[model samples]
Target: MRIAYLILCHGQPAQIRRLVMALPPSSPIFIHVDARTSAAVHAEIHQLAYLRAHIHFVPRHRCFWSGYGIVKATNQLIISALASGEAFDRATLLSGADYPIKSQEHINAFFENAGDAEFIEAFPLHAPNRWSNHEGLYHGASRVDWFHVRFRSRAWRSPWRRRLPLGYEPWGGGQWWTLTRPALELIADVARKHPALPRFFRNVFLPDESYFQTLLGNSRFRGAIAGDDLRLVIWDRPEPPYPAILKARDIECLAESDKLFARKFDLYRNPEIYELIDARFLRRS
Candidate 1:
């Protein structure tokens, strides 16, 4: 089974190169380095990927954390990957900060067995026009219930209190996902069929998390979603900036998590973790 990887990242070209090298060699990788990245780093990212076959770089977007730009960048990658004419069995959306924690063979086998089951997390985001059993625990209720606007030198929130456009029961989830071709196609189709969809999400805070989730949750593919992204990301850490950077101390967790990949690692802070995973998980037969 073929897996197409769509990666979105702003920095850490070296580590991203490592991520590319670790994936199944024949799997197509479509990457988007944020447009706001330094010229040097951008050049370095392209140069580092120069020799990699089936690794395509798409148009970049100036991505901001918790902004709609991230979703745009991800969509660019997805569009490029799909346009490649490859019949990918699965498309795993990742960041350059992510690395596979499983062997390439195991990774391929997992997707082969996974079939059309989408690995994404989508919870019914409690909104004014929606009612959900997932209310008390949902933290992004405001994402859909309130309007958020971000522009150059301007950031504002609240106002325009409206229900989810087009009768969608708003759904929210982690941005990362591994989905089937049909799921991604459905999302693309929905966006094209309803131009207002993207515009609605463009004003929502962190559209990357809600946009796709809501689309799939409201589509025919809803029953097929597995409700898990399958990446071992640590969120409840006692620190700022999370999906806490994976350190050497997290290596044991990575190994034991039985996950296909893990995210947000920094070679600068914990180079040994990369070495350790390369030596054991990555390089292992």
Candidate 2:
């Protein structure tokens, strides 16, 4: 079965090239480079695309961190991949900073064995102790009325004091996921049918973490979800705003994990980590 890798990238063209080259040539790659990036970066990505057939650069979206722009970009990638008519069985969303921990063959085999299940992390929004406040427990109460707003270059948490529009129970999780083509189509359809969904999530805090999860949790696709995204990410603290950049120290743990990919790597900060991975994981296959 064919797989589509949907990568969202902003910088580090060298790392992006390495990521693309490591994947199996048969898997189509669809990338969305942030529009705010420099021309040189965009040119470098275009050059990379020239080296591989079926590697596409979708329309650029001006992505803002922790904003609806991320969801918009993801939707764009899904649409672009679908429109290509490539017969991809699954679409895996990843950031440019991410790299595979498993060999491409192993990843392919694992998915093939997984059958039709979708790989995503999700949880009920109002589940007790799942959606927590600073006190560390949600106590099974809805947290919908609170709005996260960006004003004057800073984010402010204030009460929107309004309920969700579509009778959807909000859910949240890591945005990165591997979904079936049918699931991706369903998300696109949901977004298309309800213009207000994206508009409503635009003002919510980090909607990328919630938008997809909420949609799938309240739909028939929820039963098909495998409840894990299959990525090894290390968060520095409980509820960290961002995951810690992976380093050489993480190599052994990453190698041992069954997870297919790991995130937040920076070549500038930890070049040796990728080298280690290439030797122990990618090339060894």
Candidate 3:
């Protein structure tokens, strides 16, 4: 089975190159570097080996850690990968800082057995309209316009905040996903036909965590496997903006999780993570 690995890098082109080199040559790689990043780093990325032909430099935009830009970027990557007309069985989205925990052979074997089962966990979301108050959970003149407006400021509960016939449910995890071709095609079709939904979601807080999850959950592929493929991550002592970086000491956890990937690691803080996973998890070239 072929896999299209997509990574979103906000910084550190060197680390991205290293990770890309570790994967098998047959596996296609696609990257979306944040458009707002430094010009030097962006240039350095395109210069990396095997990248000139596959890389996609998405428009630089301010990505909100808790907003919709993240989702928008992911969708763009998926579309680009499919448009390549390559023989790809699945698509996996990752971060610049993440590392795979399994060998290429093992990963290929795993997907060979996983068919028709979507690995994404999805759910529904409903919330009250809050437009009456100056500061509302959502601000807009009407329900249709609420998702379109830029959230400038949240008043102390706006007049528009009102309960609707909706209740938000749990969506998918924020990081790491492998979607089948059928699923990807479905999402692409939905995205084109319903432009407003995606735009509306883009205005929502943490749309990455909601947009795809909501669509898949409401689609015909809802009954598939929710989560599998071992991926290890250590959150901060109390958990900060990202998960805890994996260190040499965490190598044992990485070996034991049986996951395909683990995340939220920084190469600068713990360069050993690279060596550790390369030597212990993946085969030496």
50-159 in candidate 2: lDDT tens per residue?
78888988998888876778889999999899998787899899899999999888998999999889899888777743456633112222333466677422555664
lDDT of 1 at 107: 88
Model 3 alpha-carbon drift over 4 Å, by segment: 49-61, 125-172, 228-230, 239-241
lDDT of each: 0.82, 0.83, 0.68
- Order of the predicted models by lDDT, top scorer first: 2, 1, 3
The clash number for model 2 is: 0
TM-score of 2: 0.92
Please, what are the lDDT tens digits per residue for candidate 3 over residues 1-285? 988888888788778987887776777787788766788988888776455444444445455565566777788888888887667888888888878889989989998997777766443333332223423342322322233334432212223432211332324434457899888898898889877667556455445755676667667877874644245667545656557767778888788787788886778878887887888778764
| TM, every model | 0.92, 0.92, 0.82
lDDT of 2: 0.83
- Cα error, residue 231 of model 3, in Å, equals 2.8
Q: Model 2, stretches more than 4 Å misplaced? A: 133-144, 151-153, 237-241
Candidate 1 segments whose C-alpha is farther than 4 A from its true place = 127-138, 151-155
- The numbered model that scores best in lDDT is 2
Supply the TM-score for candidate 1.
0.92
